[model samples]
Structure formats: structure tokens, C-alpha cells
Target: MKRLALTTASLALAAGMAFAAEHETTVRMGTEGAYPPYNFLNDSGEVDGFEIELGNELCARAELTCEWVTNEWDSIIPNLVSGNYDTIIAGMSITDERDEVIDFTQNYIPPASSAFVGTSEDADLTGGVVAAQTATIQAGYVAESGAALIEYATPEETVAAVRNGEADAVFADKDYLVPIVDASGGELMFVGEDVQLGGGVGMGLRESDTELKASFDAAITSMKEDGTLNEMILKWFGEDAATYE
Candidate 1:
């Protein structure tokens, strides 16, 4: 009887420890460390970008010890639901389809346009071979707009396809492609009208993580209220870019 009591106590203690662990203190922030200007690996090979800056600020405001984790964009949401990370800080636009699967904080970045770039000034805007990163809103738009869509695993690969003539053009977030076009020295240029899709970008969280979502949402609200988020938008996307305001 004494041995059984000791064993029961040990199991109860272990269960308590597990319960405590479920309420993790440190929040693991996830990002796609490949999207330049939004999130990317810097020369030092560390994740660096506007999202990284904003996420760190949010974490600070929330008084949470947050650590960054990189994941490919293709499987980012699935992985988040699987508990590979606690929160997704990538530049993911809030959409109804996505909302059904996961929860989002209020948008941090305001809605931005998506544009198509091609080598030819007169490239066909419709029914042309267009490249876009797989599973992105841009890809869905391309596919639905009577354009022949070719999906690539990464944004870089989609751009490469256009450059190599594998695709007639590439469609992506206008802000993400603007700097590339500018630096291309006339090699690349926008050829079609900018298409606006999806709501503004927000941090993704599992539906079960209501408390964590509230913390991030509060941080974002604080930034918006203080004009810091607008400042960040201008710093990263230029003065004309959209903001929470």
C-alpha cells in the first residue's frame, strides 16, 4: 500500500509539471526568413527585416521573451497548427479562407497592391504564363484572373522563372517587388495594373492561443496608437505606403 501511494504521488507530480509546461512562458515567433524587406537572412545569416523589427518590438511591449524560428512559407501555417511554433510573424495577409483555419491579430500592415512584372512592356496581362509563389494570395489571383499560373515553392524562384523566360511575368506583392525592379537597372519593369487582394497582413496564431493572440494584438494596438507602426511602414516601404492608420 505504501509503494502504491508513492507511485501515485509521482504520477500526480509529473502530470502537474506537464500542465505547467503547457502554459509556456517563452513565445516562439515564426517567420519565413526568405521574403526580403519583410523578412530575410542578412549578411550575418540572422533573420532580419521589417517583420523582425516589428515582431521584436511587439514582444518587448508584451513583456514576453520571444525567440525567432524560420519556416518555409509553403508549410508555415500547417506547421504552426502542429505546434512547431507558438506564433507566426510572417507577412501573411488576413483572408477569410485562412481565418477558418487559424486566428489572426488585427492587421499591422495596411492593405498593399500586387503587381505583375515582365521583360516586355506589352506583355499580355491576361491568359499569359504567370509565375507566383505557391499558396500565396497572389498565386490565387493569378490563377483566377484568366492567367496561366505557374506556382513555385519560393518567391525567389517565381522571380527567377520570369527572368529566365520560363514564365511571361511574375505576380507578387507590389512592395516586395518594387525594390527589385528599381535595382534591376531597367531589366525588369511592371507591366500590368496592380491588383489589390486580401486584407492587410497580420500575425497568425492557432485558435487555441487566445491569450497569446491578445498579447500581440495589444502590442500592435499600442504601436498604432503611438504612431510607431506608421513610422515603421514608411521606414520599410516608403512614405507613400499604407499604414494601420
Candidate 2:
């Protein structure tokens, strides 16, 4: 009788574990599907980029089902707070100001340099009209750097402002501007010294979602340990981009 009861208990436990695995938690990942190489809409209009792939991997590792959600960059945080999405996987940098409203996973990408792209090689970086996406670190830097700051809602618009001569240069992450400058055919070139801003990028979650944050943090740590995160970073950002030491 004792042996039979023990076998029945073990079977029941295995069945319960199977049921739990089949019904994993679903998490919505929000991104600004506009920042290329980081996150963007592909030719088929689906969200596709480094973050999308990385977010999916993290979700799988954490045994969570993920749904991608696209939000405008300016309102990304507000929407996350309002429950439009469970977490922000957008290439958001970790900063004390942002932490006041939401918690963040450990840094995924390392701190990167921001650079200025201008029509002319000699374009004035300071005391000149500079364009930056609103609410970005580059925008804040431009505003306080003695430059006449012009803010745009989208990163594309900031680049366009420089092309149209509305602004002398556009200030943004060097990783974002590298391909654009190379594709500009000499129309746009990097000017002035590179500026490092903000801490490394990480996923943003509401402070209440401590469990969710832990899952992602662990997934990120695993990727970093096995060199998979560095591989993905280089695949997207190229050889010159920073990686874990």
C-alpha cells in the first residue's frame, strides 16, 4: 500500500509540472520600432531588429510568452507605466531620472558614445543649431552645450533637419549614425568629438514587477556569461562597437 501511494504522488506531481510548463506567463514587450539596428519595422512591417531578437530570446529563457508592442519613442515610458505594455525593451539607457519611475534590468549594452553628423566637415558643434530627438540624452546635451537646440519627435526627423539645412548637425548615438553617414555618400560626416552619455541600456519595468525584472535580469546575465550577448551585439552593431570585457 505504501509503494502504491508513493507512485501515485510522483505521477501527480509530474502531471502538475507539465501543466505549468504548458501555460507559461505572457509578457508584452514594448519597443520604439523606429531605431534601426536597435529596433525597427522591417520590410514586411513586422517589428524586427536587435532588441526584438534579444527580447524574444530572453522571454524564451525565462519561460515566458512574449508579445511585441510598438510605441512612439516620446511616450514609451508613459505607456509602460499606464499598462500598455508589461516592459520596455526599447534601447533605453539606464539613468537615475528614469529609475525614479521604473526599475531596470542589469545593463545589456555597454555605455556608448554619441556623435554629431553634419553637412560640412567644419560645422560648428557648439554655438550652432543642433538637432536631436526629443527626451533623449543627446537632446539634453545639445540644450546645455551652448548650441541652439532643435528637438524632433523622431530620430529620422533629426537627421532630416540637418539635411534640409534647418540645423547645422544632428546629435545621436554613434552606433545609430554610423551606417547613415556611410550611406550619405559624403553628404553627411561626423564632426566634433564623440560624447559619452548615460549608463548602458537595459529593459525598463514597473517597480511593482520585481519578479518579472528578476527573470529578465537572469536571462541577460546568462547571455553575458556564455558570450551570446556579445555575439549579438557585434552582429548588429559591428566590430567597432563595444562588448563585454
lDDT of candidates 1 onward, in order: 0.86, 0.88
lDDT of 2 at 109: 95
| Candidate 1 residue-wise lDDT at 199 | 91
Question: Per-residue alpha-carbon lDDT of model 1 for 1-245, expressed as tens digits?
Answer: 64664454445434433433676567889999999889999999999999999999987766677889999999999999999998888889999999999999989988889999989898776978999999999988888889899999889998899899999999999989999999999989999688889998999999997767776776777677668989988999887788764
Global fold similarity of model 1 (TM-score): 0.90
Q: What is the lDDT of residue 125 in candidate 2?
A: 84
Separately for all candidates shown, the number of backbone clashes (residues 3 or more apart, or on different chains) is: 0, 0
Native-referenced Cα lDDT, model 2: 0.88
- Cα deviation of 158 in candidate 2 (Å)? 0.5
